[model samples]
Target: MNVPAYAGPSSVTTRSGDALSLPAPRQDSEFSIERALHERRSVREFGKTALTQDEVSQLLWAAQGITSRDGLRTAPSAGALYPLELYLVVGMVRDLDPGVYRYAPAGHKLMKIIAGDQRHKLASAAHGQDCVADAAAVLVFTAVERRTTRKYGSRGVRYVHIETGHASQNVFLQATALDLGTVVVGAFEDDAVGKVLQLPEGEVPLYLMPLGRP
Candidate 1:
């Protein structure tokens, strides 16, 4: 498919330390939606191949990239609050230091949160799921309930979850298109995940997706 290119600012680190820029996401893809859907599977095993920076960019874009000048994302959000926040637990991505990076969707870049690979800890929090440690990277989806809760009240809780589902499905479809393997891991200890990622006080972990070459 013919997709538009991003003619925005180049990726740059805001400060010193491990913070680094990510490659711009490629808008075009030859992969067909029908084929991706047909091939999509909950893959638990992954090959040792390291994911490229472009693949990482594309996956993050699929999850929460801005699709228009107005900043509409690939996934739908309740009341357009966009409560979901994406984190990358890196292990084996090319040209990227292993660590936890937060996805800055507005900038289409990543901000380093914690340095060093934490895949093993994440796998432990995920109840010994090898995929968490084996995959090149794991996408951790979290949410700030107050962003939607204040607008929708208690029902906003459900909306945040639904939004996460939409984002997770986008990752699955994108992984399929890229010939990568991934699985949605929801059976993790919430507190453990929070501690491992050192999440902000208000954000809470909702879903974990481990992705790599199949």
Candidate 2:
């Protein structure tokens, strides 16, 4: 992982190295969840078209951003004990460093962890899925067990998994609306991913969704 001294421009200024542009917000009349669901498919092959940082921000926001003044997320957590932690495994996203970054849901920002093209390693870790290698970005759904367990006891673990599904669905629909492709990947070595993302012991990988232009 190459961490350049400057490490390029911040995520805000560089929109995939192209001129800064914003994607049109999902309009009530234009973008419908039902429509996106109908159009959603697991796209394994992708064009080399790069995704912008703004696009990533919006996608992450939809996945699990704070939706209220009290730090409630987009998905309902059991007892409001939000346990799901989002991580982005960026590959081809333009203008951003390639690496794993934890998604800070409260502030809606990427906290860079290991930097530089770790996607190839992730691909190998994911049982040699070329999509993991080629994706513009991969969103990892991880959970800190005790966040929910502390509230609901052992059964809280079940609720946490359900919450993760809700978040992943949100990403799927949002990506579909953006005309991007996404596929949910569950087969992988959890320990390997945790090491790659530098997650703590209790933070467990629950799901992986690789995203890119179809």
Best candidate, TM-score: 1
lDDT (10s digit) by residue, model 2, range 1-214: 2222333334543233222333333324477878998998888887666676766877888888887799988788888888888888887665776778787775456677777777777777788899888887898999998988987899998999899889888888888888888899898888887877888888999888888888
Residue-wise C-alpha lDDT for candidate 1, range 50-149, written one tens digit per residue: 7778889899999999998988999999988899999999887766778899988876778889988899999999999999999889999999999999
Whole-model lDDT per candidate: 0.87, 0.78
Which pairs clash inside model 2?
16-94
Q: Model 2, residue 173: displacement in angstroms? A: 0.4
By lDDT, the best candidate is 1
Residue 85 in candidate 2, Cα distance off native in Å: 0.5
Pick out the ten consecutive residues of candidate 1 with the lowest summed lDDT: 1-10
TM-score of 2: 0.86
Candidate 2, after superposition: displacement of residue 45 in Å? Answer: 1.3
Error of 1 at 159 (Å): 0.6
TM-scores of the candidates in the order shown: 0.91, 0.86
